[model samples]
Target: MKLLLTSGGIRNASIHKALLDLLGKPIEECAALCIPTAGYGHPMGSPEGAWRFVTGRRSICPMVELGWKSVGLLELTALPSIGAARWEPWVRGADALLVNGGDALYLAHWMRESGLAALLPSLEHTVWVGLSAGSMVMAPMVGEAFIETRPPITGEDRALGIVDFSIFPHLDHPGFDENTMACAEKWATEIGGLAYAIDDQTAIQVVDGEVQVISEGNWRCFAG
Candidate 1:
């Protein structure tokens, strides 16, 4: 599956280009799935702004829109519990999935509780795009700083483990200087997973079982 694990959202034209590059050539041919912005701490915002900005600039956003067949996972929260009738075809026919940013922990629970976590992996052919918390929740563990307002990590708090490594996105965000790196180092030691330190505008693309750095900014890959 093709995946773009961005540090956060796209910050500029160059960054947007990298995302399209990671995904594929004909942006129109690819069906897009957009996870709601509930997790990005900007529930009222549009994580798609970055996407629309880029694709609109290229005059190709509508081509990728899946018409009425597209589904939003946030809306699924309102659906009846497990015993309810099966979901619509668009939810199942989605060719690509974009998990936007937000509270990593909340997103995790949402995924598991809503059955998206289980359902997603079954879409082996689907391209999964993750940004910020969207990316963090895919990793085996999340960095501690993200839980500043929450309790400590417990076994139940662990992420989906889709990505074996722990990622520290928005490395340029203030208050995470030397001490934050030290904290990341400590977490790396304690958790025993590979670490990624990526700048705000950077991203890493994992495709066909290979990892490559994208974006115009700098990044570092740390191993335990």
Candidate 2:
């Protein structure tokens, strides 16, 4: 499988270049399916607030800026009742799956419950592009030490385990709450496995289980 896991969405030229390289084509020729399920489960101050947050955050601007041909938004909440086979057409048609960030555990639950997780491994031609919580859910376990949110509905700590390591996103990001280098350091030690702490400017690219770090800023890996 090919994966591009990022602390944030495609943020810089270097990351953009890396993504294009993975696609092996110009962005203008690529089509992506944007999954915003993680952000749906996040708690805002109120229901209206949450709605606004989710709606406002749902945008294909980044991909459009990169010259992608088509970008479709697929919300997980709307898919649980639908048959998994119904989604195969969309999944198979896209060149990449762009997962947005919010609550990692929530995303994992839906990915499994909605049957997306099982279908992903078979998508040999589709690149999995993850942003923050989207990236974190691909690991065996998700570190919650730095996340400021309500507990997940699934009440499970383990993730999809598509990748063997854990990821700590937004390290030292001043704009976010409870995200710091110190928090990442403590979490890495507590989790006791291979972990990466990456800033918004960094990404981890895995091609057939071979890991590569693509970055223009700071990042660190802790192996315990």
lDDT of 1 by residue, 1-224 (tens): 56667765555566566556655544455556576533444443455654552232313222223232343453335433642246534555666676666667667766766677777656656666676777787777776656532423553447777777878777756765743566556666766668787766677777666877776775677887
Q: Provide C-alpha RMSD values for all models, in order.
A: 5.5, 3.0
**lDDT scores for all predictions?**
0.61, 0.79
Best by TM-score: 2
Report the CA-based lDDT of candidate 1 relative to the real structure.
0.61
Worst 10 residues of 1 by lDDT: 57-66
| Pairs that collide, model 1 | 39-102, 39-103, 40-101, 40-102
The TM-score that candidate 1 achieves is: 0.71
